[model samples]
Target: MHICFICDEYPPAPHGGSGSSYRDLSEGLVAQGHQVTVVGVYKNPQWHGGKGVDETINGVRVVRLPSSPSWLRYKLQTLSDRLKISRWLKCEHQKNPFDIIEASDYGGWLRFGGPAGVPTIVRIRGSNYFFDVELKRNGDPFEHKIEEAALARADFIGSVSRYASERTLDICKLSHRSCTVIHNAVDMDLFSPSPGVSRERGLIVFVNSINPKKGIEQLIDAMNVVCAKFPEAKLAVIGQDTQKPVDGITYVEKLKQRMKPEFLDRVIFTGRMDRYKGVLDYLRRAHICCYPSHMETFGIAAIEAMSIGKPTIFSETGPGPEVIEHGVSGLLCNPHDALDLADKIVAILSSDELAERLGTNARCRVETLFNKKHWVQRNVEFYERCISSNSHENGRCGCK
Candidate 1:
C-alpha cells in the first residue's frame, strides 16, 4: 500500500513525539515493502530555506515545503499552510495516487481530502481545546472550529491513547464519533538496555520541553525535597526551552530563582538533545527517569525511558495509568503534589533491588506492547481498512 503522512515535525530535524512516532511507522512500512512518503511545511527556515526539499532517507521519501511567512496573522498563517499542503497533495495525487493520507489532528490539514480524493485518517496527537483545558485558558474558537471540520471530514480517526481520544471527542462535542487507539511506539532495538553505559548513582533525568503543562514546575519542587534527602541528587533536564517566558523571566531562570539556595546547582538544563545521538545515551546513563506531566495524551518520553530499562516515575494523570501498571511496570506519582512525586523519586533512588525490578518490568512491558514492529503492522491494517471502505463509495467511515 502507498501511504503519505502529513506532518511538520519529521525527524533528523527537531520534532516532538508525533514526528518520532511517524518516522518509526513510515520507516517500518518501507521495510515491509510498502511505499511511504512524508510531506510537511517545516517551521525552520534553515531546513528548506525558500525552496521545498525533496529527499529520500532510509527508503522513505520526505518532501518539506518552505516555511510560511512569519508576519501573517495566526489564522492567515494556518490558511497558508492548508493551501500549500493541499496544492502539493493534489499535484502529487495526479502523478501517482496515494492509497491513504494520514495527518495529526493538531490543525485541519486533512480537510483537503475531498480535493485529493484520498481517504484520510486524523490521528489525534493533540488539539487546541485539549491544551487550553490543560493550561486552564479559553482557547481560540476559530481553531476549535477548524479541528471540528477536520475530524468530521476524516475517513477514519485514531488516537495515541484512549484518554486523548475521549477528551478530544468530549471537548470537541464529537462523542458519537468512533476513534481507534494505537499507542505511540519506540524503536525497541535502538532503545533497549545498554550495559556499556554505566548508570549515574544519583542522577534523575527529565525529557520534554520546559513548559508548565509538562509539570516541570512540580518536578523542580520535588527535586528540592529529593536533594535534601540525598545530598548528591541532581536533575538533568533534556529538552528545548520554550521560546517565550512565562512572565518577564525565562522558564528555566524562573525555576532557578525558585529553587532553594543549597540545592541551586542541582538542576542542570541540557537544552534539547538529538533523539538518536543524545536522548538514548542520557536515558542509559540516568539512575531514574521522571515525566510528571499534568496532562499528557500519551507520554512517549516516559516510554523511551522505560524502553531503555530505567525505573521511571510517570504521572497518575491522563494515559499514565493505561501505559504503565503503577508499582509493576513503573511507579506513578501525583504530578500536582510535590511531596508525592518526591516520595516516588526517593523510593527508586533509595533501593537498587526495587529499581532493578521496576526497570526490568518496564522494559518487558515496552517490548510486549509498544514496540515499533507491532505498531507498524497495526497501522498498515488500519490504513488498509480505511482504503477498502473508501473504495466501496460508502458515505460512512470504516471505523463506524
Candidate 2:
C-alpha cells in the first residue's frame, strides 16, 4: 500500500522526538516493501529545503514547503501565497492521490480529509497542550495554532503512549474518534549493548532537550546530591536548549548557580548534539542514565539508554515508569525528588552486580519488545487496517 506521511519534523531537519520517530518509522515501512511519500516542512538552512512543491530523500519522494516563523519563510511559507496550500493539495492529488494520509497530532490540517474527501489518519505525538504546561511554567503562550487546525479534522488518529492517548481525548473534548496508541520505536540494532568506556568518576547522563517538561531541573538537583556523596561523580547533559532550557535553569547554569561548588566542576554540557552516534557513544560511556521527565509520551532516550545496556533511571511520572517494572529492567524514582534520584544513582553505581543485572535485563527487554521488526510491522499493520476501513466505508474499493 502507498502511504502519505505528513509531519513538520523529519530526518536532516530533526528538532525533537517526532522527527526522530518519523525517520525510523518511514525507513522501516519502506523496508516492508511499501511505497511511501513524506511531506515535511523544509528545515535545512544550507539547502533551504521546504515547501515549493517537492524533493526526494533516499528513496522516498518528499514535498517540502516553507517552514513557519520559527525561521526560513522565504523558501517555504504558505502564508504569503495564502492559496498555496490548496494548490499543493491539488498537486499531491494529481501525483498519487494518497490512499491514506497519516498525520502526527490531532486535527491540524483541515485540508487532509474526512469531510474533505480523503481518508486521513492522524497520529498524536505529544501536543502543544503539553507546551502549555511548560509555557505557563515559563510564562509563555501558544505557538502551534496553525498545526492545531490540521489535527482536529483527520479521519484516523494515533499516539505513542497511553498518557498521550488520554491527553488527546481531553484536549479534543471527545469530539473525534478516540486516539489509537502505538508506542514510538527505536533502532535496536544501532542501540544494542556495546563495549563502552566507563568514567572512573562514575558519570550520570541525561539525553533530551533541556526543557523543564523533561525534568532536567530535577535530574540536576539529584546530581547535586550524588556529587556531594561521590565528589568523583560527574554529570553529562546532551541536547541543546531546544525549548529555552526552562527560562533560567540552563543546564549549564543550573549547575553553576544551584549546584554546590565541588559538584559544579564535574558538570559538562555537550550543547545541542547534532550527531546521534556521538551521543550514543556518550551514553555507552556513562555509568548511569536518568530521565525524570515532567511528562514523557514515550521515553525514547531513556529506553535508548537501556537498549545500549546502560543502567537507566526513569521517573514515576509518565512513560518511563510504565516502560520498566520497578527493580526489574530499570530503576524508577520520583520525577521531582532529586535526592531520591541521586540515591538510586549512587546505589546503581556502587554495585557492579546490580548494574550488570539491570543492564542485562534492559538488553533482553528491548530485544523482546522494541526490536525494529516488531515496532515497524505493528505500525504497518495498523496503517493497513485504517486504509482497509476507509475503502469499505467509501462504498467502493479504495476510492471516493
* TM-score of each model, in listed order: 0.95, 0.85
Best prediction by TM-score? 1
In candidate 1, what are the lDDT values of residues 195-239, reduced to their tens digit? 789999999999998888888999999999999999779999989
TM-score of 2: 0.85
Rate residue 233 of model 1 by lDDT. 93
Give the residue spans of candidate 2 off by over 4 A: 42-53, 68-87, 110-117, 131-149, 196-201, 243-251, 395-400
**Residues 216-240, candidate 2, lDDT per residue (tens digit)?**
8877778777777775688888887
Candidate 2 positional error at 182, Å:
1.4
Write down the RMSD of all candidates, one decimal each: 2.2, 4.1
lDDT of 1: 0.87
Top model by lDDT, which number? 1
